[model samples]
Target: MPTTRDYEYLLECANVIGVDYNEAENRVKVFVSQKMPPETLADEDDVKKRVQETDADVTVDVVDAGYDDERAGYEPLSTLEVIPEALEGRGERHRPVPAGVSEINAISTAGTGGPYPARVTADATDEASGAVWSDAVGADDLVRLSNNHVYARSNEADLGEPILQPSPQDGGESDDEVGALVGYVPIDDGVRVDVAARSVDRDRESDRYLELEDEWPTGVRRDGYEELREETVTKTGRTTGVTSATVEATSASVNVDFGEGGTITLRDQLITGYMSEPGDSGSAVFLEDGELVGLLFAGSTEQTICNRIANVEADLGVEILTEEPDDGNGDGGGDREPPVYTTTFERALEVDLEGASLDLESVTFGGRPQPGATVPLRIAVVASEPGSYWVDVDGDRERFEIGGESSDDLGHTVTASAAVPEDAAGTLSVSIAGGRLE
Candidate 1:
């Protein structure tokens, strides 16, 4: 049998994968949270680490969690709706986030009359997120970035239309002119490629984002598609402030709602946590190191979906600006990475002596100890006064004695052990002064 120390190491490595011990063969099994596809299954190394604790020939098993979003079965329909209904909805704007400020949670709007400022987007009802394409777009020319569905209303939008800031539906009066519509791509396969909206006459930060960090964004890395899984990613948006989550699915196909009950099937999309909310679409996704990863688009109750930021840059023809942290000491104190530790999970066991009024309580490996591991039974007998108690097990007839006669109100708690069997069930009979309990 492997020592508990040996078992503990495997337990750490198993973390969320869950642990299963095969006592007969002295093997401990750990399963992956999600089964990576065959070509990518090699990534399992991310979860399975090479940790050897002892020389005792202990077998460790790794199991795949299997690939499945676990969504209820839905018929693959030839979706009929093409253009999405208005995404912008009526919501009052709080304090105005002046242009040129970093970490600005944005809103979208659409209108006429000299490209008025009032919350800008293709729809006037909802507050969708937007980004700046160029820091210097000719005298405060806000070269904002967004999807054609947002800036153009699918194909219903025009080339030279109004783009407001607080969006009129959200009470962006005609006086809040931010920019005008310049370039955009029509929707194709549920996503708009090469999309950009230009907002002029506004001072702004070069390349910053609404981030979770107390400090500002340092630099931005692009398209970390491969290394994103199981790694934490973050985003700041128009609606849900700042949120972070691990990328769960690398390639997913989903049908999403876009208001007025319209739906589209988006493929080759990355899925992360329940971060982004209604108006977070168009918010940027970044890594802990402040590297831009994806464009926040569609999502469900369980996930946030988006395209690689690399694709966003290539299609839109713009570059994201960044400034890496630099502490004067140059010891890299500004960006010092932290260390990590693993946590173990433990469960307790409970049993009671029929008439003996004795309670057995001990926490072990999920309440059932590994075979060959002793289950220290907390034998507690309630009596008016401490006295002799004889305990005998039914299975093996093992006998033990606890306490010579004494005095105590809470009763006596003595120690006992049982060589757990394969089924992990034990029964005992206890005899005290006046009564015998089984």
Candidate 2:
């Protein structure tokens, strides 16, 4: 259980290393360099320590050159990619308790429609993680809440108990129309509560009003109900504090123009939930089963707004939370290979010579090449116009023309001498294009 601070740090590291979150593995993997032949040490532990200490640039490689030479050590190569983001701290663990839970309080906002309920419980876990009292039933190990209301469940679900849901308006009346409510869920035995609200109001000139947009909600579902249905609706919001009145209006569908004339049509929803508050911007909106639905992004007095989870996932290529594993061991066991992106270089050649002439044909480059690895080039030449020609390679060429051309088309070969620079580390590309004529 990494803290928010830890998560932020990991994100920053990923950005620096140019690695994005891999939703499949729920981890981040980045390509880093290591010095060649890693520092020699006493044991495996020493090797691990040296590997960590070495600057990320050089790499160790094991290769067979067939030659019987001791001094000719294999060149250091970049072959390994490290995954540092996967190492997150697992927080305190707790099991669910059964029985002796009850609701304590319930309240409704003056301008809002529903009679929202709040509950306290005899059970410590229930008390810690706010569970709204409801007739809703859940699976053997989970608690269920109706609609998208905020609620909590014990690690052990057989405890069939109910508690009041916390109210957004729990504190004293607020005169200011704009404000946010904060709640927490304990990573250990602490209490967790979910809150929601809606609001509506006019634009600056009072000429038009804004409303909630309809879109897919977040979270998976077990009950017959489909979570996050696509539907249109209205919303109510308080322009000021809790003391303010409710403002309601219809949500609008508009195309928001963004970077470089690109436009995205946002189908806002008028869903019943809080989407605005000073600090609620990143709060997650989840379905009853605790599946993520959306993120509270923005809103005005006229509408509580949120970005759909599907859209967020599609855009960021990351998942907010994954399904909790059933194993009590606390280890989410699943390892994955890192993702690899590649680039290629290819070209054709054309050459004309009087009688016997050599011309460069074409070059193609590719490999699972690692950063800072010097790649040997492979070159091939073909004589198209029919003539005898001699071919010559400019750099540390591997192959050269040994005899005269036999047919109109002759083939020749050479090795690449290009070296991958440190900065442009990942992969290397080489292309050669030319032909010979005689």
In order, candidate lDDTs are 0.41, 0.25
For candidate 2, write residues 238-356 as lDDT tens digits: 22111111212112222222212132223322223223332222233444333434433233222344444443332222222232223422232232111111111211122232233
| TM accuracy, model 1 | 0.43
Worst 10-residue lDDT window for candidate 1 reads 337-346
Clash count for candidate 1 is 28
Q: In angstroms, how far off is 176's CA in candidate 2?
A: 30
Model 1 lDDT tens row, 60-176: 665443324432111111111221222222132211222111111123342111111112222211123233222222321224555444555544555666655444444565433
lDDT (C-alpha) at residue 113 in model 1: 15
Q: In model 1, which regions exceed 4 Å deviation?
A: 1-142, 190-195, 202-207, 211-217, 258-263, 323-438
What's the residue-level lDDT of 27 in candidate 1? 58
